[model samples]
Target: MVSRILVPAARTAAAARSGLTMRSIVRGFQTSNVVRQEAATVVAPVKKPVGAFRGGLFGFLLGATASGAGMYYYVIDEYRVSNELLTEDIYALQTAVQRIEGYVRTLEEKVHSKKK
Candidate 1:
Protein backbone atom coordinates (compact mmCIF):
# COMPACT_ATOMS: atom_id res chain seq x y z
CA MET A 1 0.00 0.00 0.00
CA VAL A 2 2.77 2.44 0.80
CA SER A 3 4.61 1.59 -2.44
CA ARG A 4 1.51 2.32 -4.51
CA ILE A 5 1.12 5.79 -2.94
CA LEU A 6 4.82 6.65 -3.34
CA VAL A 7 4.87 5.80 -7.06
CA PRO A 8 2.03 8.19 -7.94
CA ALA A 9 3.68 11.04 -5.94
CA ALA A 10 7.01 10.52 -7.77
CA ARG A 11 5.29 10.52 -11.20
CA THR A 12 3.49 13.77 -10.41
CA ALA A 13 6.72 15.51 -9.36
CA ALA A 14 8.48 14.43 -12.58
CA ALA A 15 5.58 15.70 -14.70
CA ALA A 16 5.72 19.12 -12.99
CA ARG A 17 9.47 19.42 -13.57
CA SER A 18 9.09 18.64 -17.30
CA GLY A 19 6.31 21.22 -17.65
CA LEU A 20 8.54 23.95 -16.08
CA THR A 21 11.44 23.11 -18.42
CA MET A 22 9.20 23.29 -21.51
CA ARG A 23 7.82 26.72 -20.42
CA SER A 24 11.37 28.10 -19.97
CA ILE A 25 12.49 26.88 -23.40
CA VAL A 26 9.43 28.41 -25.09
CA ARG A 27 9.97 31.77 -23.31
CA GLY A 28 13.63 31.92 -24.41
CA PHE A 29 12.75 31.33 -28.08
CA GLN A 30 10.01 33.98 -27.99
CA THR A 31 12.38 36.54 -26.45
CA SER A 32 15.05 35.88 -29.10
CA ASN A 33 12.52 36.31 -31.95
CA VAL A 34 11.31 39.65 -30.55
CA VAL A 35 14.87 40.95 -30.30
CA ARG A 36 15.64 39.91 -33.91
CA GLN A 37 12.50 41.66 -35.20
CA GLU A 38 13.36 44.90 -33.32
CA ALA A 39 16.94 44.88 -34.70
CA ALA A 40 15.63 44.62 -38.22
CA THR A 41 13.03 47.41 -37.83
CA VAL A 42 15.51 49.97 -36.33
CA VAL A 43 17.02 52.93 -38.31
CA ALA A 44 19.67 52.56 -41.00
CA PRO A 45 23.37 53.39 -40.43
CA VAL A 46 24.83 56.70 -41.71
CA LYS A 47 28.41 58.07 -41.63
CA LYS A 48 29.23 61.64 -40.43
CA PRO A 49 31.52 63.65 -42.78
CA VAL A 50 34.89 65.08 -41.67
CA GLY A 51 33.72 68.62 -42.53
CA ALA A 52 31.29 68.62 -39.61
CA PHE A 53 34.10 67.95 -37.18
CA ARG A 54 36.27 70.62 -38.84
CA GLY A 55 33.52 73.20 -38.58
CA GLY A 56 33.09 72.47 -34.86
CA LEU A 57 36.84 72.88 -34.35
CA PHE A 58 36.83 76.20 -36.24
CA GLY A 59 33.99 77.56 -34.14
CA PHE A 60 35.86 76.57 -30.98
CA LEU A 61 38.96 78.43 -32.15
CA LEU A 62 36.95 81.56 -32.97
CA GLY A 63 35.47 81.58 -29.49
CA ALA A 64 38.91 81.15 -27.96
CA THR A 65 40.27 84.07 -30.01
CA ALA A 66 37.54 86.39 -28.79
CA SER A 67 38.07 85.35 -25.19
CA GLY A 68 41.84 85.79 -25.51
CA ALA A 69 41.43 89.34 -26.89
CA GLY A 70 39.34 90.34 -23.89
CA MET A 71 41.92 88.84 -21.52
CA TYR A 72 44.73 90.65 -23.33
CA TYR A 73 43.08 94.04 -22.87
CA TYR A 74 42.49 93.32 -19.18
CA VAL A 75 46.17 92.42 -18.70
CA ILE A 76 47.34 95.56 -20.48
CA ASP A 77 45.15 97.75 -18.29
CA GLU A 78 46.46 96.08 -15.15
CA TYR A 79 50.06 96.58 -16.34
CA ARG A 80 49.45 100.26 -16.93
CA VAL A 81 48.04 100.73 -13.43
CA SER A 82 50.99 98.83 -11.95
CA ASN A 83 53.47 100.94 -13.94
CA GLU A 84 51.93 104.15 -12.56
CA LEU A 85 52.23 102.87 -8.99
CA LEU A 86 55.88 101.92 -9.56
CA THR A 87 56.68 105.36 -10.94
CA GLU A 88 55.12 107.03 -7.92
CA ASP A 89 57.17 104.81 -5.58
CA ILE A 90 60.38 105.71 -7.43
CA TYR A 91 59.68 109.45 -7.10
CA ALA A 92 59.02 109.08 -3.37
CA LEU A 93 62.32 107.23 -2.92
CA GLN A 94 64.21 109.98 -4.74
CA THR A 95 62.69 112.66 -2.55
CA ALA A 96 63.63 110.79 0.61
CA VAL A 97 67.20 110.31 -0.58
CA GLN A 98 67.59 114.03 -1.28
CA ARG A 99 66.31 114.92 2.21
CA ILE A 100 68.75 112.50 3.77
CA GLU A 101 71.65 113.96 1.81
CA GLY A 102 70.82 117.50 3.01
CA TYR A 103 70.69 116.33 6.62
CA VAL A 104 74.11 114.68 6.29
CA ARG A 105 75.60 117.84 4.85
CA THR A 106 74.25 119.99 7.70
CA LEU A 107 75.71 117.59 10.31
CA GLU A 108 79.10 117.71 8.60
CA GLU A 109 79.14 121.57 8.60
CA LYS A 110 78.28 121.68 12.33
CA VAL A 111 81.14 119.29 13.09
CA HIS A 112 83.59 121.33 11.01
CA SER A 113 82.64 124.63 12.75
CA LYS A 114 83.18 123.10 16.21
CA LYS A 115 86.55 121.81 15.15
CA LYS A 116 87.66 125.26 13.86
Candidate 2:
Protein backbone atom coordinates (compact mmCIF):
# COMPACT_ATOMS: atom_id res chain seq x y z
CA MET A 1 0.00 0.00 0.00
CA VAL A 2 2.46 2.66 1.17
CA SER A 3 5.25 1.05 -0.84
CA ARG A 4 3.14 1.06 -4.06
CA ILE A 5 2.26 4.74 -3.71
CA LEU A 6 5.72 5.90 -2.52
CA VAL A 7 7.55 3.89 -5.22
CA PRO A 8 5.48 5.34 -8.09
CA ALA A 9 5.70 8.88 -6.57
CA ALA A 10 9.49 8.60 -6.27
CA ARG A 11 9.81 7.36 -9.89
CA THR A 12 7.70 10.27 -11.15
CA ALA A 13 9.77 12.76 -9.15
CA ALA A 14 13.01 11.33 -10.58
CA ALA A 15 11.51 11.39 -14.16
CA ALA A 16 10.49 15.01 -13.67
CA ARG A 17 14.07 15.88 -12.73
CA SER A 18 15.33 14.21 -15.90
CA GLY A 19 14.42 15.93 -19.17
CA LEU A 20 14.34 12.65 -21.19
CA THR A 21 11.02 10.81 -21.77
CA MET A 22 10.26 7.14 -20.96
CA ARG A 23 10.04 6.32 -24.69
CA SER A 24 13.60 7.64 -25.19
CA ILE A 25 14.94 5.56 -22.31
CA VAL A 26 13.30 2.36 -23.62
CA ARG A 27 14.71 3.00 -27.11
CA GLY A 28 18.19 3.53 -25.67
CA PHE A 29 18.10 0.11 -23.97
CA GLN A 30 16.85 -1.66 -27.16
CA THR A 31 19.12 -2.80 -29.99
CA SER A 32 16.46 -2.57 -32.75
CA ASN A 33 15.19 0.86 -31.71
CA VAL A 34 17.97 3.22 -32.80
CA VAL A 35 15.89 6.16 -34.06
CA ARG A 36 12.66 7.98 -33.13
CA GLN A 37 10.00 8.26 -35.82
CA GLU A 38 6.38 9.31 -36.00
CA ALA A 39 3.65 7.32 -37.68
CA ALA A 40 3.31 8.20 -41.40
CA THR A 41 0.33 8.07 -43.69
CA VAL A 42 0.85 5.39 -46.33
CA VAL A 43 -0.59 5.79 -49.80
CA ALA A 44 -0.41 2.82 -52.19
CA PRO A 45 -0.57 3.51 -55.90
CA VAL A 46 -2.99 1.31 -57.84
CA LYS A 47 -2.86 0.61 -61.56
CA LYS A 48 -5.94 0.36 -63.71
CA PRO A 49 -7.07 -3.05 -64.93
CA VAL A 50 -6.73 -3.99 -68.59
CA GLY A 51 -9.89 -3.13 -70.54
CA ALA A 52 -11.77 -5.53 -72.82
CA PHE A 53 -10.82 -3.60 -75.93
CA ARG A 54 -7.11 -3.77 -75.13
CA GLY A 55 -7.28 -7.47 -74.36
CA GLY A 56 -9.12 -8.16 -77.58
CA LEU A 57 -6.63 -6.15 -79.60
CA PHE A 58 -3.68 -8.03 -78.08
CA GLY A 59 -5.37 -11.35 -78.73
CA PHE A 60 -6.11 -10.40 -82.30
CA LEU A 61 -2.54 -9.36 -82.91
CA LEU A 62 -1.17 -12.56 -81.39
CA GLY A 63 -3.52 -14.72 -83.40
CA ALA A 64 -2.76 -12.87 -86.59
CA THR A 65 0.97 -13.26 -86.01
CA ALA A 66 0.66 -16.98 -85.35
CA SER A 67 -1.54 -17.60 -88.37
CA GLY A 68 0.65 -15.47 -90.60
CA ALA A 69 3.71 -17.47 -89.59
CA GLY A 70 1.87 -20.73 -90.28
CA MET A 71 0.77 -19.56 -93.71
CA TYR A 72 4.27 -18.40 -94.54
CA TYR A 73 5.69 -21.81 -93.70
CA TYR A 74 2.96 -23.55 -95.66
CA VAL A 75 3.63 -21.41 -98.73
CA ILE A 76 7.36 -22.06 -98.50
CA ASP A 77 6.77 -25.80 -98.28
CA GLU A 78 4.45 -25.73 -101.29
CA TYR A 79 7.00 -23.74 -103.29
CA ARG A 80 9.75 -26.27 -102.48
CA VAL A 81 7.54 -29.22 -103.46
CA SER A 82 6.41 -27.53 -106.70
CA ASN A 83 9.96 -26.58 -107.60
CA GLU A 84 11.13 -30.16 -107.11
CA LEU A 85 8.28 -31.49 -109.29
CA LEU A 86 8.96 -28.90 -112.00
CA THR A 87 12.68 -29.78 -112.09
CA GLU A 88 11.82 -33.46 -112.51
CA ASP A 89 9.48 -32.62 -115.38
CA ILE A 90 12.17 -30.51 -117.02
CA TYR A 91 14.65 -33.41 -116.84
CA ALA A 92 12.10 -35.75 -118.43
CA LEU A 93 11.41 -33.27 -121.26
CA GLN A 94 15.13 -32.87 -121.92
CA THR A 95 15.55 -36.66 -122.29
CA ALA A 96 12.59 -36.86 -124.67
CA VAL A 97 13.97 -34.04 -126.82
CA GLN A 98 17.37 -35.82 -127.07
CA ARG A 99 15.72 -39.03 -128.20
CA ILE A 100 13.78 -37.21 -130.95
CA GLU A 101 16.91 -35.49 -132.21
CA GLY A 102 18.71 -38.83 -132.46
CA TYR A 103 15.86 -40.33 -134.46
CA VAL A 104 15.82 -37.37 -136.89
CA ARG A 105 19.58 -37.63 -137.43
CA THR A 106 19.26 -41.34 -138.28
CA LEU A 107 16.50 -40.60 -140.80
CA GLU A 108 18.68 -37.94 -142.51
CA GLU A 109 21.62 -40.41 -142.75
CA LYS A 110 19.37 -43.03 -144.39
CA VAL A 111 18.15 -40.47 -146.96
CA HIS A 112 21.77 -39.51 -147.74
CA SER A 113 22.79 -43.18 -148.20
CA LYS A 114 19.90 -43.80 -150.62
CA LYS A 115 20.80 -40.73 -152.64
CA LYS A 116 24.47 -41.73 -152.95
lDDT of each: 0.80, 0.78
All candidates: CA RMSD (Å)? 9.6, 10.6
Q: List the residue pairs that clash in candidate 2.
A: none
lDDT of 2 by residue, 65-113 (tens): 9999999999999999999999999999999999999999999999999
| Candidate 1 clashing pairs, residues 3+ apart or interchain | none
Worst 10 residues of 2 by lDDT: 31-40
Error of 2 at 69 (Å): 0.3
Runs in model 1 with CA error above 4 Å?
1-51
* C-alpha RMSD between model 2 and the true structure: 10.6
TM-score each candidate.
0.53, 0.60
